[model samples]
Target: MDKHHSKYQITQLSAGEEYSIELYPKDEVVKAKYIGQGKLEGFGNQHLFISEGKDKNYIAMNDYWLRKKDDGILTYAPISSFSTLRINKSGLGEMLDSENVHYKNLGLRIIRFLESFGEKFD
Candidate 1:
């Protein structure tokens, strides 16, 4: 858990795979579709950025493109920047260096902790 990424809620979509801003809305797969990829910007604390089966057309501080699959394949990107981002193994339930976590309720953190699920919404 790093200082920068741990501040926001990470929408971990997959267990073994890592998704980064570099490969998200601007990836080759996305650009191949529209000959351009949308940009994510001008937002902060963008939580639950994108849901399953939905299109990624908006930018937020904390957001996701979409649930790629039921196997947890979500990618996360930090807002407030217009530069390249480093790909790391940050996830939803990762503790923030084990010190700053006291700021957030431990119980709530546990409640928010989920291993995996088939559906992305109700």
Candidate 2:
């Protein structure tokens, strides 16, 4: 996998490869792409999920996960299914209301997960 870095860092993962992303400040827009041959599986059986907000604050974007099928690869990104759960468990919406954009409870979980794998976004 070729690794590149700028405002964001890039790494290529192989098929059935799993990775997590957590952006800092909770307001920064982030993007990701999978390079080379392989399948990329993301959180919640999905490749994308936006955090809790009445309006769109951040957009979680990533390359669609791909798998080999009949000598070809099919790609798709599942919808986010965690937003409502996060709001219910931690009152994430209320927490977001308090902070300008620092970090929230559930947000920290994502950050920690990404950091656990030595990934960071600013």
Candidate 3:
């Protein structure tokens, strides 16, 4: 794990590997598969994509930024700021970061999903 964010660690995903992800707050968990890393457009940054049926979402390997708000809420800026996040090899993750209410709620949902799989976050 990165020293600055010892609580978070990222396990690289393999192509075609299937996993579960919590994409929305209070929503049912969805099945997802690693699609691979690449850029959608010539000028875009390289990123990894996961497919949940017909829906595809990108996970930015780098440039995933986050911070804590004054009210102790977590906030994140996907491609703009800094923080640490890791999804373990067993498909578990811990994120101590996000501020916008929507993103904060979404983060909590993800944490709950990971907890369901036996992962815990501080």
Q: After superposition on all CA atoms, what RMSD does each candidate show versus the true structure?
A: 14.5, 13.7, 15.7
Best-to-worst order by TM-score is 3, 2, 1
Candidate 2 worst ten-residue window by lDDT: 78-87
In model 1, the worst 10-residue window by lDDT is 28-37
lDDT of 1 by residue, 1-122 (tens): 55445544544343333243324444522111111122323322232222112342212223342222233333333422333222112322344334555523432232232112121211
Off by over 4 Å in 2: 1-32, 35-74, 77-103
Better of 1 and 2 by TM-score: 2
Q: Which stretches of candidate 3 lie over 4 Å from their true place?
A: 1-4, 24-28, 42-46, 50-122
Question: Which lDDT tens digits does candidate 2 get at residues 1-122?
Answer: 21211223233345233333333335222223322221122234223233344532332334433222232222222222232121122343455455646555445554444344444544
Q: What C-alpha root-mean-square deviation, in Å, does candidate 3 show against the real structure?
A: 15.7
Each prediction's TM-score versus the true structure: 0.19, 0.26, 0.33
Determine which window of 10 residues in candidate 3 has minimal summed lDDT. 77-86
Q: How close is candidate 1 to the true structure, as a TM-score?
A: 0.19
- Predicted candidate 3 versus true structure: per-residue lDDT over 1-122, tens digit per residue: 34434433334456677655433234334455545444322223332434434333333333233323333223333323222223432232222343456555655654454344343456
Q: What lDDT score belongs to each candidate, Candidate 1 first?
A: 0.29, 0.33, 0.39
- The runs of at least 3 residues in candidate 1 whose Cα sits more than 4 Å from the true structure, single-residue gaps closed, are 1-47, 50-79, 82-90, 102-122
Two-way lDDT contest, 1 vs 2, winner: 2
Top candidate by TM-score: 3
If ranked by lDDT, best first, what sequence of candidates would result? 3, 2, 1
